[model samples]
Target: MKKFTQYVFCITILLSCKKIGTPELQPINLKISTVYASTELGKKLSLSKVLIKILNVNTNVEKQLITDANGNVSFQGISAGVYDISATITIPAATYSSVTGEIVDKDVIFNASDKNKTIGLTNNELNIKLVSGNIGNWLIKQIYYAGSNTTTGAGYRDQFIEIYNNTDSVMYADSLYFAEIIGRQSYTNTSYYTLPNGQMDWSKSLNMPSNIDANNNYVYPRALFMLPGKGKEHPVLPGASIVIAQTAINHKSPFTGTDGKTITVRDPSLTIDLSGADFEAYYAPFLPRPLTSDIDNPSIPNLNVLAYNGTDMLFDNPGRTAFIIFKRDGTEVKDYPKYNYPTISTPSSTSDKFYQIPNSVIIDAVEIQPNTASDRVPKKLGASLDAGYTFAPNGQYSSQSVIRKTDRTENGRKILKDTNNSTEDFDYFSLANPRGFK
Candidate 1:
């Protein structure tokens, strides 16, 4: 009886010891402060904010909280790690680029250690741009790079890009050229580029005598697609837009391709009825390419693939790409300096195929990236082009497209936001709703 009682007591103590040894993890405290970038102090940001959002990078978890009057926010006992914090603060209307009711938004990444980690969110208006005054009327409103999923579960032919005229007058889409940037962002990382590599590092002027527009224009393009039309042949009136498709046809209907094989779209709604699309991009030069799925519409004019530096111009599913629609003016291709490499990435590889486009002629430009921050590329567009880059949540082949935010409508014209910052100017949809018809 004594031995049995002792064994029971020992088992009870062992269970208690295990409970004491394996204590639950205690959370840590995180603090956040807000500020507005000061050009006076030169990059010094002042604090001001009412609310803030803290996001866990890995877990996709988010928390919203109000900041104290002093622009400080505290998260007690949060799992210590890295996080992205965003705060939108209303500043003096005259202080920032945003005119009326515009809020200065700032995002800062913080690493929260065991103790308290104070992260500062800075609203650097130095790079913030406004949609008014200088914003062009024509914009690349939407692009569906994530092709639809056909019945066979493969789809790329349904890709399309839509252009809109956000002005009160008609804008011609005629003779407009579309170029794909060859490099991620030329000025992103300059230390790695050297003259022996043929890559033009914006840091160093080639010194080779020429009137090249290589100063402010860093992102260069190798592929060029042009919209062939007379000056007024393709008139996109105010509040109007046009869809440029890979093939203008009802993707749902069964169709015969170059191989004389019937292709069917398993899900009708999943696909888009682009039969009425205004423009198409057909690899005219590479026509009859084996197993070429690209279909040409007899009614729609094709966007001549003027150039193709990459293997496929079908736009990458996740490749960070920057694009611009510019009218071919007197700017001679020879006038611009050349980045003599395939891309800034492959600096050692040689090629004289890239040319820089003067920013003035670019009607509108947009940069697409992956949903996550680390998957993003160095932003190529200046605050004048697009303040930031946007991405599809589902990434590739998800049929999601980045759509521009509507600022307002003036005199029957839809004035889309052109703050030159995609983060503030654009958002994503569950589906690619082209021309707002989703």
Candidate 2:
């Protein structure tokens, strides 16, 4: 009886010494469903496979998977956390009628550590039109809109645009009018937007010609920076490019802004020396203080500013704007029609006036905006003018640029992609590639 009592006492002591701990963590299951299909032409309508990339925002852990025919893929086990999943798919041009599509969607999610979840992706349809109009022998090669590196944290003075002759024969840059568009970015801001409430009424904004339809003709820029030349003063040969700077004085050198403060270029390698630039946007001496960033280069002719709104000839450093380069026959000021912008609410105000230049004169056009999709609005340029839009990645003064992609070449002439879709035609580079081509 004494031995049994001793054994009970030992059991009680052992139970009292036991420790408590949490249960082990369980792995997560990830399932993705892609949206795809087939067409009447027996071609697969979408990408044969989908690319799924999941990034853990906290730990920076990455997981990738390719979806099969069923548009389905699953991860066996994943340690759950906050993740950003970006999915992309491309349809072959052969499948569609010369017009194919590409889709990309990035997401943010908080996944549970031990749960099976499915991410259903909505399939987007993009109809990329083959260029209806010939993109011409000349192309706008690179645009350094994001400014340059500076020690003072202000470096937009180096803003420059580059053009190229992609044709076999020589083309003239003479009499080319480069313009910066000014208007509302999206339809949501009715008070500020040109066409509020997404009105399809073209008569409200455009000044159409008698022979043209309002749908085709668009509202052109109010002010134009005209390149002064008679006929062939500026000739661009095949496989050649020209840089147009705000100041063609080796921007790599130090520059003084309106503040009269010296701004040192942090990385001269990041900027180019445009000392031999083809042209520069030179404003007149009469131009006031703030707009005086327009440095004068006597050797490089000034682009005549045709002002309609009485505003200075300048660019909005942080605004959603568009640009175009065009040359037309009889492009003298008289050839274009006069447009008076009547505020949607106040038609009699006569606050805005414009000189409408038709799309026929536009050689090339590019639409630029902020990088986010939700922040973007209806495109200002027509589908025929520019089917897609491109942007500056990191807001204003980020030192980024939108560079055009080379589509193909015929003979020896390089034909940059003129698909009019910025998504396909343009891409973002870490640093600006200016005058990379002579």
Instruction: Report the number of the highest-TM-score candidate.
Output: 1
For all predicted structures, in order, the TM-scores are: 0.67, 0.64
User: Where does model 2 exceed 4 Å of error?
Assistant: 1-131, 149-154, 192-202, 205-215, 255-270, 290-292, 308-313, 347-350, 409-413
- In candidate 2, clashing pairs total 0
> Tens-digit lDDT track for model 1 on 78-178?
66444544454433435542332334332221111110112222311111111211256678888877776634433777777888887778788887777
List ranges where model 1 is wrong by over 4 Å: 1-134, 150-154, 185-216, 287-291, 309-312, 333-337, 342-352
lDDT (Cα, tens digit) per residue for candidate 2, span 146-208: 775555433766677888887778877877777776555555656532443242334554343
Q: Name the 10 consecutive residues with the lowest summed lDDT in model 2.
A: 107-116
Best candidate according to lDDT: 1
